[model samples]
Target: MEGIEEKLVVSTADVLDYHSILEAVKDCCALFCCLDSQDGYEDKMVDLEVRGAINVVEACAQTESMEKIVFNSSLTAAIWRENICSQKDVDERSWSDQEFCRKKKLWYALAKTLSEQAAWALAMDRTLNMVSINAGLVLGPAVAKKNPLVTMSYLQGAAQMYENGVLAIVDVNFVADVNVRAFEDRSSCGRYFCFDQMVNTEQEAVKLAESLSPLISLPPRYECQGSEVYAERLRNKKLNKLVEGTAC
Candidate 1:
């Protein structure tokens, strides 16, 4: 399929800066996808993201031709109910509690929740046609360069969760594909969860890692078990219907 026009790729060197962001969105449609690792013990990273998103939305509203906006949120924004374990169904309505996030020290979840909330609030206030794509752990072919934190903390060790489990994983390519589709599809609105399958334990992660890349050493199975904070059962009926009419 033909790719999006190069003119559509509005490069903003300073996404978090208000003046710079506003300058980038002038006379153009904007799609803002936010991804940062504030997981584990990090405290203020999430707040930074929330502030940046607000700035971006404000900037976009200033543009005369800015038509739509898309925010990449996460499944972490939802709350997983332990008491309702028997009920496997999950959807966009589920939300992760900020208070619980503070207690558990799940910086990633907190960041996602806060950033999404800020975006929603701003979108409502500004009356911007915005949508957020909430997804699970994204995995695919490794990028050329690997950083220390990504290589050691997140990629190498599988000693986090112990039982139960977290949400599923989506390939990075699938993520990019869906993102482009979301912007092109006029019917796209609100939050959409993206994950191919669920990975419950470190054992399962190791298996997946081995299959995806045989060279990498798999860590001992550990359970980073967390409740499925967001519901995974979101109807992609709109997405499907849109894709049918347009190129993916």
Candidate 2:
């Protein structure tokens, strides 16, 4: 019940009302910040993400029982930027350049990058335990139909990402599992890049297109006949360590 009397000032809103967030997280040991913005409102998405993250982290700061926060973020936050080729390895430490995102009109990437940054800054200032899951384009049953905006936004620079060997995907189930494991395992710290497949080859790209189905258009009777290979630069060593630790 420590810090229970600390009153935080937050803007009024139908959603993300400060009091509501505080009440919901009361006595909770852990928090998962999985936020998304609707596709059409690109202009307001950044503001929404930044504000939502601030409110959530501020609330967690007031809850003494809060042990850790598992923030769900997209790999786009780490992969988009100029001169990606210069970086030998892209990992949790990698961050997308905000200026590049704005210049390219990659609103989703900007939103995630800024929001996650905001959350981390506030969490560190408040001394709250936190970890982030920077996942790739999440794919699962009916993904295109269920999360069209998010899925498409993550793929905005698909060609560049693919060429850089950073275009990747992870199952929705794997993302969920990672979030939970990161929360429960105290050894898990900082950021973990979660992905299962990298779309570097012609065959892999075709498979991704097929998985996204009608959302990603393919030529009539398109077929994948190449086993082309590209060196994948993104790494998930931290995530592997977490999985290994859990299996023990």
Candidate 3:
């Protein structure tokens, strides 16, 4: 409990030193989370997330105080399909195929799938209590105060599929609230897909954006044939049940 008094947040670069991690969590519980970006580091982002989790787990095992580990995965990992609109329902069992990701150059989707897969593998192998929240396109005000435009840029549009006719949308606050709930609710295991609304095409996104705020201009429409990475027979009953009473 000596060194755990201070809270430290490390990025991918700082994780290179395993000793630093062990030292930091030597006396207290540790929680590991990652919010990876899709830009650059396409080949290594998955490995980075895996290694990051390993570092945290190893540290926790040594300390015997690591309470939980949470990962912020994306709904893109679940909704990469040619026809999500036709889907009666979707859930955690769904996965985006790497081949389709390669074809569409969907680096963000690839990052989520690879990272979550790595995390799942590690969690099972190490017997770690791990939970992941698969989130949709996060929309809200900017966290950093740097520039409003930078924040607005991300909120302005939907994914290519959403513009074309796929994927869904979730409020940033809802995603945050769910992440917190997952940590507090011991029953929260496996993966939870968090989204406020589902948008089939880019035009739909534009319409919704216009309704939300007249100032925002919708992006141009684009054609995107979704991928069928997983069989449509997968089940998401648990997630649907959870969403039944909850307000987004």
* lDDT for each residue of candidate 3 in 49-92, tens digit (9 for 90 to 100): 55765665555556677777777777767666555556655668
Model 2 pairs in collision: none
- Stretches off by above 4 angstroms in model 1 are 1-12, 37-41, 79-87, 143-165, 201-203, 209-248
Candidate 1 worst ten-residue window by lDDT: 153-162
Query: Model 2, 117-166: lDDT tens per residue?
Result: 99999999999999999999998888668888878888888988888989
User: Of 1 and 2, which scores higher on lDDT?
Assistant: 2
Q: What is the lDDT of residue 100 in candidate 3?
A: 76
TM-score of each prediction = 0.74, 0.90, 0.67
Residue 184 miss distance in model 1 (angstroms): 1.1
lDDT at residue 5 of model 3 (Cα atoms) = 55
